[model samples]
Structures are given as C-alpha cells and as structure tokens.
Target: MELLNLPGNIIETVVRMLVNQRKTEEIKIRRLNFVQCLEDVLNLRATCVRLLEIVNNTRLKFPCVVNFSWKDPELNFDLHCFINFMANDTNWRFETVRFRKTLFHVEETNSGLLSIMQKNASLFAKSVARLNFDLPLGSNSIVLNVLNLLDWLRRESLKAGGQISFCIKDPFFSNWEAVLLVDHLSIRGSLRRQFDIFIHLVGSQKFPNLSQLDLPDIIFPVAKLCLFRNLHALSICNLELPENEHIPLHSTQITALLLSYAELESDEVECFSNVLCQCFPRLVYLSFKNTYRTTFSDDDNLCLPETCTTVETYSHMLFYFKKCQSIRYFNLQDYYPALDRKIFVKQLLTTLGTRTALMSVRFCGKELTRTDFMSAVENIVEECHSLDVLSVDCCLLDTQDSLNDQTEIDLSKIVRGEKILPIDGQESEAMLKLKDLCRDKQLKLLIMGKTVLYKSTADVRLMGEINKLEDLYKWNLKRGCVQWLSLEN
Candidate 1:
C-alpha cells in the first residue's frame, strides 16, 4: 500500500518486480504443453516505460518492442533531440521492433505495413536491434512493398547492429501451408520474386550482422540456402529441398540450426548431412521435426496410414548423423521406426550408441508404441555407457490409460531401493511406467512419454513434482534442450 502511494518513479521499480513474480507463477502452472508466443517476445517493460526510463536515465536502457503505427503520437520532447540522444546512447538497444499488418481473411493490404515502416524506420534505428515482421496470409502478394521494406530495414537495422526474424502465419492453420496458401500461387513469378528478395536479404553484404532467419512453410521450394554471415542461429520449416542440392561452403558463424517438416529421402540423407556440416561448420545444435510422413496406401479398399519409420531412409539417417560430430545437441521428432522391432533396435543402438560427444538427444514422436520404444532405448543404455541425457516427448502420438492395472511393474524397488510410487488421479499410465523402469540407470531420465527403464533396473517415486510437466522437462540453462523455440517464434 505504501509503495502504491509513493511517487510514480518509485512505483515503476515495483512494477518490474511484479512482472518477474508473475512470470515465475505462470511457469509453475503451465508445466506441460507450455504454449507461448516466442517471437516479438516483448520485453517485460512497456515501450513507453522503457523509452522514458532510458531517455531520462541511461542505465535503464533495455531492448523494447514497438509495433508500427502510421498515426504515431509525438513525445513531449523534440524528435530530433531524442534521436540524437539515442545516437550517443550507444549502450541502449532494443530487442526487436515488430511490424504487423492485418490478420488472415481480413481485407487489408501491405500499404499500411509499408506506411508505418517508411515513417518510423529512422526514428528508432539506434535502439532497434532486431525486427520481428509478422504478416498475414493475403490473397494478393505485395512483392514490391515487402522488398522495399526489407531493403529499408537492411539499411536501418544494420546501423543498429541487428537482424530480422520474419514469420507469416494465418488465422486458420497451425502450419498447413500447402493445403491453403499454395492456391495463391497462380502468378508463377510472384513466388520466385519473394524468394529472390529473401535470398538477397540473406546473402547481402549490406546487412553484415543479419542473423537469425525463420522462413517457415510460407516460403517453400527454396531454390538454395544462402551464406548467412555472422549468423549465430537459423530456423527453417516446411521446405522441400531440391533433389539437386547446392550447399554453400562452411563459412558461417551459426551454432544452431532447425529444420521442420522437410521432405527428405533416405538416399539423400548422407548428402544432406554433409551439406549441413559444410554450411554450418561450427554448429553445435541441430533439430529436425515432423519430417516423417505417415504415408497412406489403398489396402483392402481402405486408405490406411503407415505406422513405421522408413527403414532404408532412417538407416541412411543413422549413417549421416555420424558425420555431424560437431552437433552436441540433436533432436528428432515424429521419426517412427519403419523397420521391424528387432532391426530397429539394432539400428538405434548402432547409430546412437557410440556417440561420445553428443550431450543430449530428444525424441518426440506420435507413431511409435510404448513397447517398441522402450525396448530400443534399453538397448541404447546397454550399448552406450557414456551417454547421460535422453528425453522422449509423446504428446502427439498415444492415448492415455489408467494405472489400476495390477501387472504394472514396481520399478522403484529395484532402481532406488524404494517402494512403488503412488499414482495421482490424472497421471498417465505410460509416463508412470517409464519412471518406474528408468530411475535406477546411471543415465539421467528425462522422458515425455512411457518407455523402458532402458537399463537392467527400474525406478518409481510417488512425488507430485515428477508428474508435472515442468519437473520432467527442466528448462535449465546448462542442460537446456528446447526444440520448439522456432515453432513458437
């Protein structure tokens, strides 16, 4: 009460504390399926508060996100003086400035988007270190406007020593581009023109610090991957790599690479792996998501979907992973095994068993059953003594069952020398089984689904924390393994 009654200046400090506390509480509540908007992650402070504090007090300078608006209000001070102050305020920089237009299905044009960017690009150039351009899926493609905006952004944002992350999302879909937007490709050259602009933005020397690119399904059939100078991380989704690949020389500074929903063949796995190694020589983290397609065939007058992973292709995948020695963290999602359980077990161990340098491996899939997955991992633990961290995420694939089944093994007795863990009312039977089996092994268990204890022993602990999503998936910095950052961004 006293703090609220104090002067507004004193109240601002309290507001920051309140914001931090709220974040902690939010994380605690949403333990699993932590849904969030990663892009334009507006800093805790509001734009007005941030700019006011920084302009008045330089120590408070922090990155601020501002949405572009044509009819912008004038501040109390002179615009020229404010910009000049920012020029001298070298330490102060913004995280990103977002430029968004209309939503999907709305009859809006890029004119407003361009209008705001044209007017405000230079005003906050010094403080804007990054740009998050969120655009809607419009029927008409404004290639020239977008190109001009990118060109202007290249000139302005480069001065601020920053880059841009572009995202094109629609109202209806989570990420189904071909199903909806592909029809807008009637004008053949428009798509190519957009690609040209994007490629130019990546390869251009004008924006030397241009880094962190996200070209999701909106820009598929990309002709080539350009060399991103000074780029530390890159993300791409829904791209169909050309059969005839053209990989750039490993002249990049990128450390993290993510490819989602990329259609790749087993025969091409070796070539693609080499291409990745060549393009990002210093890469330490790599992730591939939803790459396995559930192919459906007409079987007995029914279109049945295939459940297993492509054997020859995945076998090649294992072979290719060997070349990526630099990858410390690797994530494979929706890669259901196509081979028989026996052969799949052999392949899993042969590919992942000997890798001594890999610090983390996260497997999230929908198609693999609990039994096959557990057995394969058990072999992995048997073969590899050095590997420590293994995580599984099966949110998309399976149905939950009750824990009342009496045949359920009591793993805690064997692994931890403790009694069986008591199941909460809502606890999934699958996860409980995994914890029961995997607790005793030397390897640290961080699983998202039910799988084998993987070692000779089992584990079980009746702890409330273990059942929560936050506990199973610890978001620690040193042991951080986030594969869905690009999806949210």
Candidate 2:
C-alpha cells in the first residue's frame, strides 16, 4: 500500500482529520462541562439532553443527575430535542429520571411546548416516575401546559402499564383555559371537573400502579372523595364544602391527609367530623389550619339540613377529636382566638385523651396566656401518652401596656423556662408555680423576647430552652447565634 509516494494534499488531509477529531473531543468536553454548570443552576432537563447528545454522538457513558428548569431558553430547546431524540432512539436506557421542583412558566397563553410533550408523551411517561408539577403563582398559561402534560401522561401510562408519582402545587391558580382542559378530559360538564379528573386518574384500574399523589392547597368537592383509594399520601389545602351542601362519610385508603384552611359552617362541623371519621379510617397523619364561617339557624337554634351538621360551636370540636382517635399525628391551628381558653383546652383534652396512639402535636395561635398554653400542653401530654414531639408557637400572657418598642417587653427569662416574677403585685406565686411545672415536664420552650440574660444550668431545669432575644446587640450578633443554633441539633 505504501509503494507510491503520497500526494502533499493527502498527507495534509490525514493531519487535518486528526486535528478535527481532537477539536471534536475538546468541544464535547466543553459542552459536557457547560451542561454540568447548568445542572448546578438546577437546570436538569437541559443537562440531560446535552449529555444524551454527547453520549449518542461519541458512544460515551456519562453519569449525571438530570434537572429541568423552564426559565432557560437553551435548556428548554435542548429538552425538547432530547425528547424527540429519545422517542426516535431505541438504544437509550435511563436508570432513573427525576423531575423535581421544576417551576413551569409559559410566556404566552398558548403553550407550544405542551404539544411537543404530548407528541413524545410515551418516552416521558416511561422515563420519568417522579414528577413535580409546580407552576408560578399567577401564570395561567402554565396551567394549560400542566393539564396537557398530565393528560398526555395519563393516556400514555394507561397504554404502557407504567406508574408515575405526580405533585401539583397550588392547583387553584389555574386559569379558565386550564379548567376547561380538565373539564374536557373529565367528560364532566361542571367547571369543577378537575377534581373529577384527579379522582378518575387516581381510582382508574387502567393506571392502577400509580404510587404517590400530592395536591397542595386544592379544594375538592364532596363527589370527589371516592377517588382517593390506594393512595399512599394525599395533601389537600383550603378544604371547603360548597354553600348549602353536605358530604356524607366515605371511606378511603389514604395513609396521610394534610387538611388546611378547612372552611366549614358552624352547623356543618358534626357532618365534617362524621365524614372524616368514617371516610379516612386508615389515615395516620392529619393536619388542619384555620376555619371559615359557620352557618347557624336563628329560629330553631339548630343546623339547617342543607348546611353542615349542628356541631358548629366550639364544643363540637370535641366530636372531631373523638372521631380522629386513630390518627397518630395531629397538627392543629386555632381558629377562634376570642373563645375561652380554658374551655377550649378542656374540650381538646377530653377529645384527644382517648387516642393512646397519638405521637406528635403542633399548636399555633395567638391570645393564649402562659397558663392557657401550659394547660393545653399538659392536656396533650396527659392524653397522648405516646407523644414524642410537641411544637408550640402560641402567644402567652397578654400585656396591657402598649410599649412602642417590643424590646421593652420582658419576655427573655420567661421563655428560657425561667420563673417570671410578677412585674406588678398580682399573681407572682402563680407564675412561679407554672415555671416549676414546665421544668418538671422538661418542655422545650421558645420565647420571643427583647433581652435574654444568660442563666446557669443550676438556676433552671428544662429539656431545651431557646430564647430569641430581639435587642440591638443580640440582633447584631444574631448570625453567630443562628450558626450555633444550627449546630446544636
């Protein structure tokens, strides 16, 4: 083969080929690094595509986490290309794919990206098992994008026999177009058809292998309760009944239910209580925050049949407490600040007392005196004998003096499980006695105060005493305190 002398151009061509190969290698390396930088910025989808492209071109095996960010134009383009390539390529096999914390923001009302997603829906449904569908708070266009993506995913999963865990953050922010999209899929004529779609997706045997469903801050109508069977966890926010409507008890197989901003009429509390007790019998964790108006009949002094049951008064919460006895963890937010603290505490104690399985309690509210707070703690400690964790952020002891500076308020010693001496002549002994009780119980006390004087261990005995001193000096040095605090646990 080397009999004839090679031409000068032929030699140059071989040299040029070698140089171009090196340049291609360098380019691939640079592109890979760039994709990694994007991943560091939480741009996973782009990184995946870029890596995939490099791998396909060079036959190189690269292992990296794929994160998707909707904000980057190049990243979005790369993602769309990657999806198209994956759909066409049969050799690519992903060990794991995660779509975590990617907030979608569509610039226009119509989402062209959704059509691309729908076109390659099977590849995405097969590759991705964990997906987080978080959209910007007010982006109506993103909702349509989500609905289209979800609908495509649902259809694809049904055909492929694959399961997906989907999380929707703030579903109520969706615009009319998104709502209509859900309605169209649900085949239900009502505007509130998304709930039906969600239930249908959850309950359908066609997609029986679906594992996790997270719906944050979404209110479900009464008809949608049956769709939650076999779910591992369900988080609902702003749970409310339509006016003049009542939901009966229906059992679900969900393990966890986070109920926030439960808007129910006073008369409807009993019905709500019954529904909770009967429906979510297997629920292990239950969380609730805030309340709505209660409907009370004036003439008969009873609940209207169309409204919630007549258990709307504060006394009715006890009924809920009794019904939710099987729940292991309860996080409650007090709705009524003006109600008698002693009476409320007593009712709570009586209701939760029967639940020996209770393990944790989180209480948040205002207008709770130190005594009132202690009473509630004691009630939980006594009733939920198995309780391991207790978090309380309730305001203790109302002060009449309106000091312009909140720093002038003497709260340091009081919060550090220290005995608060009466600044005035009234009830000094009671304060001292309460301190002794807190110390005896080994309660972790967190007090927000202006000045906190360091005390020796010999002075007081408590499990954890965290005093957040709000004075100027403390505020300046607060960073150090925060660092120390972070290191403590």
Candidate 3:
C-alpha cells in the first residue's frame, strides 16, 4: 500500500524492477516450483489496482516449453495454469519442451491427466520435444499414457521441422519405429541379444538422421560402424570386436570418438586402429581409457611385481594414433603394461611426433620422477612441433629436496616411500620453467597434482575449459588447446 503513496515515476520504477527481477531471456524453471511462480506473480498483481493494470499490460514470460515428470503425476494437472497463462499472453514465444523419466502408477480415475498433457503437447508441435524413458516393459496403463504422450510430442516435433531425441534403456528398443525418428539417441544399458538386430536395423537405414550416439556396453563390430552414416559424435564404454576378415568403410562425418575400458589384444591393436582410421577419416578428437587399478590391497600387492604395480605402458597403444593422421586432439588414460618410465616416454614422444597435425594431448596412469617428467615435457616440446596443449594426469615424485635454496641438507639421502620425496618448491620451480618453455613455444601445459593445482594460475579461458566443460565427458579435462594462460608478459 506504501507504493500507492509514492510518486508516479518511483512507483513505475518499483514495478519495473520487480518484473525485471525475473529476466525473460532464456529462463529455466524446474517442474516442482511451477505453482509457486504463478502465485508470486499473481500476488504482486493483486497488491493494488495500479499494479494490476501494469502487470496485465507487461508481458510476464514463462518457460517456452513445459516439462513434466512422473514423480508427481497429480501436480501435472496443475500445469494447466501455466499453459493457460502462456495461451493468454500471445507475446510469449514457446520454444522446445522435454519430458523425461519413467511414467508409472497413474490410477484409472486420473486418465484425464494424459489428455490434458496431450492437448498441451499439440500446442508446441512446431517445436522440439525430447522424451527420455527408463521404464520396465509391462501392460501398465501408465506406460500406455507415456507412449501416447511420446507419439503426440514426436509427431508434433516432426511437423515443426524439429527432431525428437531419446535416452532410452534396453526395454524401449522394442519401439524400433519410434527409435528411427530419433536424431540424437543414447542407449543407456546393454543391447544384449538385441545387438545383432539393432546392428541389422542400423545397416538397413533405420536411423536415417541419427547424429549423436552413446553406447555404454556392447560388442559392436567394426564392420557395422559404417551403418551410422550421419553420426557426428560417438561414445562407447565397453566394446568387443568379432574376428572379421573384412572391415566396412564408415562415412567421414564423425568428428568425436570416446572409448573407455575397451580391452584389445596386442595383435588386434594395429588392426583396430587401422579399421578406425579407415572408418572415420574425419575424426579429429579421440579419447581412449582403460580400467587401471587406482587402489590395491596388500594381499593383492604381494602377488604383483614391483614394475607391474607401477604404471603399465601399452607402447603398442601408440598404433592407434599412428593409423589416424588427421587427429588433432588425443586423450589416453589408465592403460597399463609393466615398462620403465623413460622407455614409455620415449615411445610416446616418437609415436606422437609422427602425427604432425595433433594439437592437444592428455595422458594418465603413468608415474614418473620429477626429473624424468620434466625431461619428457622437454622432449614433447622439442619433437611435437604442431602440438599446442599437453596435459599429464599422473603425479610426479621428486627424488631429492626440490627447494630453491641450494643449502646442504642431510634429508637428501633419507629414504621415504620408495625414496620418492613429496613434491616441494623445487617441483613448482620446475613447472614454472616448463611453463616458460611452453609459453615461449606458444604451448599450454596442464599437469594434475596438488602442487600444480595450487601453484599454477589459470587464465579466464583456461579456467573455463577446466571448470565448465570437464563434466560433459567421462574424461575430465579440456580436449583442445587453450587460447591463453595466466603467464607474466
């Protein structure tokens, strides 16, 4: 009521401030708080007649697309308020809508809820609608509701010239016709016995516009890869290749490939690499990681050799990139074979140097002394001429006191934890030296360790790469070169 007594300009400013508090540009609203949002707006409008006039005239934008979850089906009926509000406000533009999670346990009495949701879906037919289902295969009425909703959303999305994307598990694979409509599809669980049928469908032109794929566990043959002619990016966690004399050539549209825990026989390494190179000729980004043991028990340690306990060097793993000359970004992690640090580094540098176009490289699972690690950095800088970014995931052990002061210390000869001393100022200075070297060569270095993490200061762009996009992939690190580093000019 105090606002009514204020000057006209002041009252108008207050109203504008309150409305602008919720910005109209690209707002995201979760499902649970939909009612509260409307209540808050209506409360403000009900405060006074002048406020009601201003609120009615001013466009209060809601989320373009409405999202509903099965967690609270009853609340879905309340969604009509928001939709009705959007309907009245012709100035509000509806964009895309996405519905996710399993749909279960809708009583027969609440069957009108599906109709209400379907009517809403029909309004947004010219926009994208993504539906992700993780449901059990059963004759439940709820599943029928979900399928019916998906049918409307998918049909509307297509009519709008937008594609529907799905993240479905094994059970939903039965709906092959619906699956074919997906532009971006991620198969969560194993395909199991249906893998062959899935492969056959893929080769038979089932997924015509499929662009992005994430296959968690499967025995996807190298020959069938060509079936995904429109794929742009692919993530495969576990893959087993069948013995095939002939390999199919894949379309060169795929640009990103991520592989984790894909075990390969030593003989099959080169063949696989050759097939991969032959298949995806345009692939510029690659990530390969194995399940290297992070922690070990004393009982298990007794059975393993000291060399085996350290980082295992799959020197032959270099064959993968050797086959692909177009790769610009490569990430290798946790593949182990018992080999000395120096030998592995030498093999890595030699193999990587041949990939003249490679711009960024990240590797984990190898342990190195500080001296050896610095030496490897120097070698990579000198040999890999085209490389602009390098990231090392392993912690380096300093053999001696790495302090800057050149004073005599008896602790140098003291043995602690296999004669490897904890990193000190010396390692930081060494990193600074490498940083300077990389800076001179126009390179960026990202070394993962407590010392580096705390000592090194990252620039705005580098920090964004480390913080924002790290979680997007299974591997946590920047994929390509950083434009800038926080280095003293």
TM-scores of the candidates in the order shown: 0.44, 0.42, 0.54
Sort by lDDT, best first. Answer: 3, 1, 2
lDDT of 3 at 462: 57
Please report the candidate that would top lDDT against the real structure.
3
* Tens digit per residue, CA lDDT, model 2, 174-285: 2433333121111112224456554554455433443344445367654566664555555556445535545454567755455545555556665565555566566444
Give the C-alpha lDDT of model 2.
Answer: 0.39
Please, what are the lDDT tens digits per residue for candidate 1 over residues 1-489? 343356665655554433332333244232211112211123423345543453344322223333333224442123234334545643333334555542322112255545544554544455455555555553434333445555666666544445455555432222222122110111122334366564554354434534555544444443354555656655666444456666333446656555655455555555554455455556544545442544322221111012111111222234334433333233333244443224335544554456532222333333434455455555555555445545443323233222122232322222233323333222244435545544544555443222323432223431122223222233221222222111011
- Evaluated against the true structure, the overall lDDT of model 3 is 0.49
Q: Which TM-score value belongs to model 1?
A: 0.44
Please list the residue runs of candidate 3 whose C-alpha ends up more than 4 Å from where it truly belongs after superposition: 1-100, 104-143, 155-163, 172-177, 188-190, 199-206, 223-258, 281-287, 291-316, 322-324, 334-347, 350-383, 391-422, 444-485
- lDDT minimum window of 10 residues, candidate 2: 478-487
Candidate 2, number of clashes: 13
What RMSD, rounded to one decimal, does every model reach? 13.8, 17.5, 12.9
Candidate 1: 10-residue stretch with minimal lDDT? 302-311
Q: Once superposed on the true structure, which residue ranges of model 1 sit more than 4 Å away at CA?
A: 1-131, 137-164, 168-193, 197-206, 217-227, 236-250, 261-274, 288-316, 322-327, 337-347, 356-377, 397-441, 445-489
lDDT of 3 by residue, 1-489 (tens): 676787766655664444333322113222324333345456777887777666655544333323334325474545565577655643332344455444444652145535655556534645443444444443445445555656765665434456556666544554465466677787766576667777777878888988888786754566667677788878787445546646444545776666655565555555665555566666544555553433222222111111111111233344433433444444443233243334335555665565542232222222434565456567776667665445553422232322122222211121111234345326556656765666655454443321122124345665544433242333334322213335443
